[model samples]
Target: MVDLFGHAGPAQVLERAARSGRLPHAWMLAGPPGIGKATLGYRFGRWLLAGGAEGGLPAGSAPLHLDPGHPTFRRILAGAHADLRALRPNTGEGGVKRVIRVEDSRDAIRFLAMTPAEGGWRFVLVDGAELMRPEAANALLKTLEEPPPRAVLVLTTAAPDRLLPTIRSRVRRLDLAPLAPADLDPLLMRLLPSLSTTERATLGRIAEGSAGQAVALAEGEGLAMQALVDQVLADLAGRRHWHPVAEAVAAKRDGSGFATFMALLRGALSAAVRQAARGQGAAPWLEGRALAEWSTLWDRLGQLAAETDVLSLDRKQAVLTALLWLTPPRR
Candidate 1:
């Protein structure tokens, strides 16, 4: 169970709406990818369908939970529920990225038009709804305009602005912020119980509230590269020779290593900035005017990252540019 942390404020609002019988026809759930936008959508959907854990957890229990053995849970997971419709990426005859085609999305209309099989609420969930093409999105507009009674639509997106403005206007928006480290730690425990405590802590920091991305980063040797980045920053601060850092990234001419290096470096910089802003102050070199220097360094690194990908520029040189931005060599 992916506990929806840092999201209770919005959830409370939604609960109030549901209890008052004024739940909106459409809801836009927007947040960073991998941070449980879709997870929360399903949770909310289950709540609307009254799919709580069987036998219940006593009064004032969490609504987001559903007993896995429950019929509603099984049907929702199996996509066999009469009152629920789900739209996501699925291949359509040689299509790429398994885009949500208009063909698949047309079912929402038919699903909403009919009465609920359970004589209760009906819902349509579009995960990563931003991935839908123009046609698929247009097809959804009519339902948004005149949804049937007891009908609910949930659209989840990492990038809400990519959606049509008309589509954005009709639904109430629920904004999900990233989970704090404290909040994300326990979730990592549940999801990756096999991981050692150190490993989970490392991933919890890098995952930054994203359970899916944490798994990806863990598998991709992100931690190993982050270690290297830490060494490089330590060398820079100690005024030690840093040529080895350059050589390490240069060894991978494929550019992926450089990208990883930049990502870790950017994370460190952002951390330092945040620490400074909290009145704890950053490292000596990162305090006061030096803070401005780090800011400039971040913006420059961002530009180089953009240009390297866009123009296919030399990655080694781009990394070196970042190192120089950190601390130039002796003249």
Candidate 2:
């Protein structure tokens, strides 16, 4: 079983199931994206396969250890484990497909019908279960209604309410919330050893309680990006013309720092707007009409961000151009 870092609720549920031998046939692990629900599911599957006594195995047990090379682990990692199946969107030659079709769900049903190859529980993990189309969801509901013995189905999603009510009712629902700062700090440090305490703290605040997002930001080229955003905002407040701003953004568009820079620019403008709304007072340099104007600019920048898909590189330059307007006039 993987040692899921934080998610005490699901951890307790797993411990209880192991102790009582009353594990549910299917469980829905629902929470915000990037939380550790998938890790928890993998850990539970490992425990089931090992036939080891559940609940508090010695801290050093091999089963608890994550060995990607182990035969069973390898199969799971390769997504070829006869006893396990995962339902996720297919992103093949035709670009990203948004829905998990009924065919895939039927395959899961077929896989579950057979006895386990290892005489253990068969585990199925559906990532983003809410992506299931109506027919696909109905197919899954049949299995949930009369799940096989010694079979475990784990469905994970950031939005569970989108799933069918029938499917939701048949399975145990475990909610995983964002990790606490104390719990996430060590992980962040490990992931970004070069980050100063101050930088890490800033990232944590921006992460908004999501440890996964914080780690991702730390790994990203955020520092350089943040610098670019700071420069742009300063220029806007200084009333610098847009032409020079556009040139600067265009120059860096292809660099390693571009994505991070764009994200930071968006976040900074958002923070400024929030501050303005709360009457927290703008930066010392921003006062009177300048502050009010920038506040409105910030609102428009946010709208642009929502309307534009950040993944589209073509749209990125335009987004940055819009952000340039947020800068104050130069003396």
Top candidate, metric TM-score: 1
Cα lDDT of model 2 by residue, 1-331, tens digit: 2445677657667656755788788889998777677887887776566553353343433324444556777667666667877788665336766888889999988888789998877778888888888899999887888888888888888899999999999989999887777766666777678888888777766675566777776666555456566666565545354445445545544443444555666667567666877898675435534556765766676656545445444444664567545534555
User: lDDT per residue, candidate 1, 1-331, as tens digits?
Assistant: 4356557677777766776656799999998888778778877777677632222322345545555666777777777777888888776566656677887778877788789888778888899888887899999899899888888899999899999999999999999888777767777787778888898888878666787777777766667767777776665654354556666765665766777778778878878887887888676545434666677778888888889878988776777677766763343
The segments of candidate 1 whose C-alpha lies over 4 angstroms from its true place after superposition are 1-6, 51-60, 90-99, 237-243, 250-255, 285-289, 328-331
Each candidate structure's TM-score, on Cα atoms with residue i matched to residue i, is 0.85, 0.71
* Model 2 stretches astray by more than 4 angstroms: 1-3, 52-82, 192-200, 209-220, 230-236, 241-248, 252-299, 306-331
- Clashes per model (N, Cα, C within 3 A): 0, 12
lDDT of 1 at 110: 78
